[model samples]
Structure formats: structure tokens, C-alpha cells
Target: MLDRRRVLQTLAGLFLSSFGLGGYAYAWEPAHQGVTRYRLKPARWPEGRRLRLAVITDLHVGGPHMPVARVRQIVEQTNALKPDLTLLVGDFVASRTRRSSDPAPAEWAAELARLQAPAGRFAVLGNHDWWQDERAQKELRGPTQSTVALEAVGIPVLENRAVRLQTGAGPLWIAGLGDQEAFVLRRRPRGLPYGLDDLPATLAMIRDDAPVILMAHEPDIFARVPSRVALTLSGHTHGGQVRLFGWSPIVPSRYGNRYAYGHVRENGRDLVVSAGLGTSKLPIRLGAPPEIVLIELG
Candidate 1:
């Protein structure tokens, strides 16, 4: 008995409601924090010593999407967890498109320096960091001044290198790898020393007796890693950024949804892919809200 006009109006109303909800989710839902906790059991881990690691990555810290205040909050949250180590995988500065970021990299690093990790705070560059300033980066210099700024704040960026830290149990080796596709965006993707990963050199530094924790921005590296190395941590997918019904339509990586988010077991190697705390490209975050990952190693 309903008229055609009435039915059409009803459909329009439903469509508008759906659009508004999506808009709200994109704008505000991402602000909701999701803390993912996990236990990492690596080979050669001492019986009594416990290591807690907090992984924070893909922090496109420019623009209103991830302002300085938010950065401070994230740092504070990490500190509150009292992790023994904090690994900051890259993308420190926002691209030119995001004009609202204040306090810049130095200020951001300063806040990060406040991070207290008895083991240490280490970092590596993400693709976004390398591509933030295309002109300067295209010249093959480095990740620009962000590295210097990070070092100034006492957090060092590690690239295909391993460092030994004396933990309560014993000595633990932590290695940081470069972004696999960092340079491809500037030029043609090529062989080793290609700006992203340097597995051979990085693994060479690991001693036979020491257990290692690896840091990589993209989770694709997880597949190639060896089981001798206990756990690999990464955060590039942003948990698909906006997932629906527990699945996101968009995930930026060569591996598709395989390494999208959370903990994954690949080739018997444990990988924790963080759902990072900041958004990229868009100001929206839905199913995958921002998070500060706390990984406990026993």
C-alpha cells in the first residue's frame, strides 16, 4: 500500500543515516584506543628474566590526524606500561599535505625521549618517513633530518644492525631493519642496500648464544625471518585502517591481508604486527582504532 515516493524517501533516509555513521566512525572512532597485549617466547630466553617491549609505529606526526598532544599521550601510555624496551618503527613526520602538525620532529622526539625503558628505546624509518620530502629523499641522502632529531632525543634509529643489551636474565640482542620499500617510491626498486631491508648484514651480527628481537616496519619481512630469531615486530597495515565486520577493505602491503594486524605465526616465527596509533592518508579510523602494543617476553 505504500506509495513509490514514500518508499524512495525511506531508502534515502536510510542511506543518509549510514553515511553519517560512516563519517562519525572515520572522524572520531579512530580516537578510541585498543591496547593489544601478547606474550613473546623466544629461543634462549632466560627462565627468570622478563622483558616487556612496547612497539609504536607509523606515527605520521603531522596534521590534525596525529598532533603533538596525541604523541605525548602515546608516550605517556607506553611509560605507564613500564616496558623494558620501546621500539619506535618510523614515519615521524607528516607529509606536506597534513599542515596542522606542530612542535615538529624535535618536539615529538623530545616527548619520546621521556620514554623510560631500562633496556633502551630504538627506532627505524618507515616508507612514509623516506617519502615525506620526496625531493630531498630522492637524492639518496638519508631519511633526512628525522634521524638526527631522533638521536638528539636519545632514541637511536637502527638500520640493519644489532645491539647487545644486558638484561636481568642475560644479554639480549635487538636488531632493527630498514623499510623494505622505502626507496622504491623515489626510484625503481632494485637489489640489496635498497633502502628497505638488509637481512643478511643484520642477521650476521646476531651471536649464536643470544636471543634476538627484530624490528621491521612492514610485516612482509616476517615470512623471510628465521626461527632462530625469536620474535619480529612491525606496524604498517594500521589494521586495515578501517575494517568492517572485522575485515578492512584496504591494507597497504605487498602481502595483502596476511600481515594486516595483530599477532601472526609465519614459518614458525612469531610476528607481532602492531595496529599503530596514528592514521595515514585519511583522518578516519574505524574497526582498527589506534593502539599502543605491549609485548611481554618471558
Candidate 2:
């Protein structure tokens, strides 16, 4: 006779652990650097202005998944690459549980400042960077505090703004968008130009015919961006965190699977969504190991 009851109990325990401590353990896996090369026609980049943009995002520091030590490793790897520009997309810290051991915001900022690039380093806030609730602001999602800390460390925080830099490639326009999760993350009313970073306002600041590279926390925003922009980068999905058979089962984008991971080109626009280098919420990573994106933009 088969002991069906015993078999079921064993399976249940396995499932529970994978979701609990098992997931957090998997998150400690060493991060990997994923290199992707893109040639953008719309970039109209001057022959000399080809840019190498390295993107590192979703470092949920202090969370059990990515502690301060692991963050140091990520910074060391990034600097070794010697990229032209580095775009940090956001979600610098967020721990959903109270039992987590997190560091002060300044600790994270000091570690991030160690990263170096020739063109410079720029960043935009992620959903986790905002306040947790409408009232208190001292929790994991520290808005003003996070901005001040990062900027003080040399990583200029670009909030709904654009900066034109004279890269070796020529004039380059880089814009940082206000996270679309602005309303959703804070539980505020949704409307245009009020709670979110105004895309129109950000785009309007760029001059005509300049090759533009925009970075947003969420990949879904890539849909609304016009084709004139040469390349758009984002890192909010975490490659679904736990993918099976090479596909993430749960991507956060409003566009669903279309913009889930990797490079997507449509209607004369190019978007590369990095898997990112840390864990969040559940604190586990399976098929989608932590990834640092190195992109050559020419």
C-alpha cells in the first residue's frame, strides 16, 4: 500500500521552504555580468560619440538578500568594466519583512560612490525608493533622505530632469524619469503631471537631433517613449525573480510579457531591460540570477 499522506506532507515542506528561507538563501548567489551590444540607427551618434553604458539596479541593500558586503562586490565589478557611462535605475533598498537586517541609507550611498565611469554616473529613483506610506517617511522607502545621501556621495539623482553631457561620442542627452509607481507605491490618486514624473516635460528639455538615452525604473514606460530616443534602459522587473524554463512567471510591467527582459525593438525604438543585481520582497532568485548589464551604445 502507498503512504499517500506521508508523500504529500514531504512535498508541502519542500514548497514552503522554497518560499521562505530557501528563497533568501538562493539570493546570495554571486552576481553575474551580462554584456549586450546595440547599434542604434536613430542614435545618429557621431562616429566618435559611441557610448558604453553600464546599468546596475535593484540593489535592495540591507535586505537579507543583498547585504553591505555583497554590495561592495557589485561596485568592484562595475568599476573594473571601465564603462563610459553608468545608469543606476533604482530600488536601492526595500525589505518587506521586519526581521531583516538593513544598513543605514548613508552606508549604501558611500558604497555606491565608489563606482567610477568616464562619462559620469547618473541615477533615477525606483518604486522602493519612495515612502512606504502616505504619512511616515523613516521606513525602508526613504525619499528625500535617499536623494540627499546618494547625491552627497557623487551619484547625482535625476528626478524628472535631463542633462546634456558632452561624451566622447558627442552630445548625449540622458533623462531620469519619475517612477510610474509614484501613485501606486504611495497609494495616491492617479493623474497626469501631478504624482508622477512628467515624461513630456522631461523629453521636451532635449534638443533636436541629439542622440538620447533615457533611464526609467520601470520598463513599461519604454512603450510611451518616442522613436527619436536612441536607447531607453530600465530595471524594475528583476527578470520576474523566479523564472521557470527561461521565462519569468511574474513580470511587473503593465505591458506584460512584451517588455519582460532583454532587448526589445519596435517602431524604431530600442529598450534594454536589465535583470538587475539584487533581490526584493520574497528575497529569492532562481532561474534569473542577479545580473549586471553592460551595454555598448554606438
Candidate 3:
């Protein structure tokens, strides 16, 4: 009889622990925001020159987890960092259909417009941005609503393009690749690329030999990223949205946790994948908290 009582107690304890963990994951971690910082001196970085970049990505705004007020708070927090460059790495709109509000594009863009950076603020669209655009999906072409909204607020959406920024270090080139999963092509056209991304053409636009920072929404592209790019930034997997002890069980990337989150260096190339600012699918997070990534480079 005593042994039976001990087994019941053990089962009760396990049940309570799981309930508590679930509550924290659902109610607490998803709402709270934090900052993650990385300082790296890439091999190609100009000597004695430093650059601070604030990266905000996977906002998935308009959802219960990320309202306009949260976006405003994010902008305020990013501005406080006083970064040299601010990068909006994409997924501004919410993908979840349930328990989500549809905040107009302008509403969120207005809040993001308040973000300030010394060099400039730049942007790239994510898969969700294109997926949400009905017209773009049907036409298999873009000028997605996400792009129009950002551009309307004076933030340039860099789609497979590169621009030179005059930073304290020197001329730094920022190249943004279009969303690789931009459109759901109905039928593959002969000789036509699957998605909107054009990495080769984008790289061709670079006229000078300045160190380059590439922004691709999905980190899978990092596998093909050449050594020429000093660093690459991405936000998509959301660090599996429930990471624990530096391992995520369900990473969305094709490469699994290899490019899941944080700084990853491979064969002389570097990539930093932000855990991102808002939840996706089901608004729940565990060990991986929402974050604004700050990268210091030299």
C-alpha cells in the first residue's frame, strides 16, 4: 500500500510540473521581449572600423503576441541601442489565422518608421510577406504589400539589391536577397526560377570591393553563401520557438538546427539567425525568448 501511494505522488508531481511549464511557455515567454548581442570581427571586416547593427525580424505583427503597441516598444528599444544601421529582416505581418488581429500595413509601418539609425534603416521581405499577398501569389510577381508599406514610410525594401552605406569604418555594402519562398508557383515555367530571389544578379549589382553584409530571410541560403560576404543575417525558424539547453527539436529550416539560431560560422563564412521578435503558428515559446538582435562588427 505504501508503494502504491508513492507512485501516485510521483505522477501528481510530474503532472504539476508539466502544467507549470506549459503556462510559462504560453503566457509569459511569448510576450516578453529581450535583446541578444553578438560581437564579431570577421576576417574581411575593415581594420580598426566598428559597426553596430540592430536587427529586428520575424515580427509577425498584428497577432496577439505582437500588437502595434509592441511594435512601438520594439522601435523604442532599438533606438535606445543607437545602432549605426537598423535592419528589418522580414516577416512583419502575422501568419497565424486564429486569435490574431489584422493591423493595417500602414499602422505597423508607422511605428517602425520611428526606428532611428545613424547610417540608415534597411529592409527585406520574408516568405510570410509574400504568402500573405493574395494578388502577388496569384500573379507570381511582386511589389508585395509589405514592400509598398515599408517603402511608403521611406524604408527602402532591398529586393535582390545592394547599396553602399558610408559608415565610420568606410563604404560598407548591404545586399538584400528577395524572399526565396516568395511565391507559390502554380506551374513551373521552363527556364524560370522557382522564387523571386536572384543572388547572382544581386551580387552583380555590387560595383566595388567593399565588405558585404547579406540579408536573406531564411538561413538555408547560408549554405551557398560564398566567402566574399563578411556576414549574413536571417530570421525564420524562430529558434524552433521552444529551444532548451541550446537545442531545438523542431527547427523549420531544411538544415535543421545547423542554421537554427545565433552566430554560425562555416568554412570562413558567417551567419547570425535571430530568434526573432514574435511567435508564429501557435503563440507559445519556452527557452527561446523573443529578441532584438544587436550585432557589433569590425
Candidate 4:
């Protein structure tokens, strides 16, 4: 048998070794790039009403970073959640600086179309789509091509339009706005042809009492959204792309990190902004992991 001093020293060394190995394993392992789920508890949610919404955005497909495998993984994970509504918040392709000869990035839309929900799947345009190649991107809506890829599979694209949902409780309106950042950056006369200014008018068109859920690409407009709208789902900030010390290093938006990522409350409107599955500008992430936000509406 070993002496007490010898045994104590041996145990100390083993403890240190194990701790070091564990730390290194955690640090070296690829950042957990998977979808994360969240439950949103609203103050006035109607009892027995459950609306599970999965929001995906900023998937800059066709790059060394995101690749096809990662995109598929995101889709699989999303479907696993079994959300009632699957909202594709845009940035499907990164075409701004890519060339025509480059492998078409729109193919991912077909992959995304596989995502199914009881109610339906819907999508809207993001700023990157317009900046990259509006014409080629628009091809996604074409029949022969992948334009209607999402819709072809079953996910309908909602561009500055609204859809009426038949919920267990009653009826709710789901509307999607076109790319707001594109118009904002372009200094266009009108941000969106039908925007916050015409929200009341649009609501008048949709006959529903369960409240309206707006799908805008970015959360910057959350402040301007009417409180009566209830909730807004968006992506595009990529949760600041890279996070540091639990905060995004740089959130590329006019609102900065305030509305950078995750769930944020602004002007009494609940907004869930996904960090996104793919990377943009860079292929690495620190504190910010790729995510699938499970928004629960009661």
C-alpha cells in the first residue's frame, strides 16, 4: 500500500490532468452549431392555444462555411421540432459577390422545401438576396427552376403578403414583408411598397381575431411595428455573426447589439431573431451558435 502523502500527490496530478483534458476538449470541439429551442411565454396568450413556430434565416448557402451538409442538418433539426409554422426568414443564398459560373446557391431552397409543418411553411426575402443577384435569386420562384423550390415542396413564399391560419383557438394572420434592409440601404423612396404605414390597411384585409404575426427579414423595424401585431419573427443579424463574452462582437445593423440576437422585447412587441444556421462574412462563431428558435405562442 502507498503512504498517505504519496497517494494524495498521485490523486492531485490525476485530477489536474483530467481537468486539463476536459477543458481542451471543450475548447477544441467545433462550436456547438446546432438548432436551439426556446419557449415564449406571452402574458396574454390564450389558454389551450399552442403555436409552435420555427424561425430560420441568414443561411448564406453555397460557401466553404455553410456547405450543403450543414444546410441539410439545419433542415433536419428544424423538422424534428415539429413546429406548426416553419418561417424561412430569407438570405437563402449569398450571391452579392459570387459569380455566375459559381455553383448555383439556389439549390439549397429545394433542400429547405423538405421542411414540413401542419399549418404550412412560408418565406420572405432578405437584404443579401437583393444585393447578391436579384434576377437569379428571383428564379427561385419559377416552376422549372428552384424559385418555387420551397413552395414546390410545400413552403410558400410570402412576399409583402399575408396568410390566414386556422388555429385550434381560432384564426390568426401571418404576414411577410419583402426585404426591408435593401430598401433602407438603397435610400428608396418607400421602405416597403406596403409597410408599417399600410399595416392597418393590410390588417383590415385579413379577417382574424387571434392577432397577427409579421415575418420581416430583419428586426430593425420591430420598434415601428404596431403593438397590436403581437409578435414578429426575423433573422439576418446572424446573432452578430461572431459573439464574444456572451455579446456579439459586431452587430451589423442600425440598432447595433440591442436587437442583435435571440428574443428581444421592444415597444411591447415580442421579437424572436434567429442567430441562423450558416455563417456570413466569416465561417467561425464563438459564443454564438447556429440556432433554430422554437417560438411558442399560447
* Top-scoring candidate (lDDT): 3
lDDT by residue for model 4 over 1-298, one digit each (tens)?
Answer: 3332343344334434776643432333223466667676554456677788888887777644566666788888888888888888887775247765444544676678678787878887777766665453333221223335556566677766788888654677888876665533333343333222234445555664567888888788787777667788888887765566767646766777888888887656688888876666544444567777787777
Best by TM-score: 3
Give lDDT tens digits, candidate 2, residues 1-298.
3232343344335645666645443534424434444544443455655677888988877665577777788889888888889889988876353232467778888988999998899999887666432332323233555677799898998878999998888788999988767545333334322235678999999876778888898888787898767888899888776666877556776676688788888886888887787766565566677788888765
Which portions of model 1 miss their true places by more than 4 Å?
Answer: 1-20, 95-102, 188-194
- Arranged by lDDT with the best first, the candidates are 3, 1, 2, 4
| TM per candidate | 0.87, 0.83, 0.91, 0.77
- Give the poorly placed runs of model 3, Cα more than 4 Å off: 1-17, 97-101, 185-192
Whose lDDT is higher: candidate 2's or candidate 4's?
Answer: 2
lDDT per model, in order? 0.76, 0.73, 0.86, 0.66
Task: Give the residue spans of candidate 2 off by over 4 A.
Answer: 1-43, 97-101, 133-143, 185-195
* Model 2 clash number: 2
lDDT of 3 by residue, 58-173 (tens): 99987768889999999999999999999999999987532324888999999999999889999999988987887887778888888999999999999999999898878999
Model 3 pairs in collision? none
Q: Give the winner by lDDT: 3 or 4.
A: 3
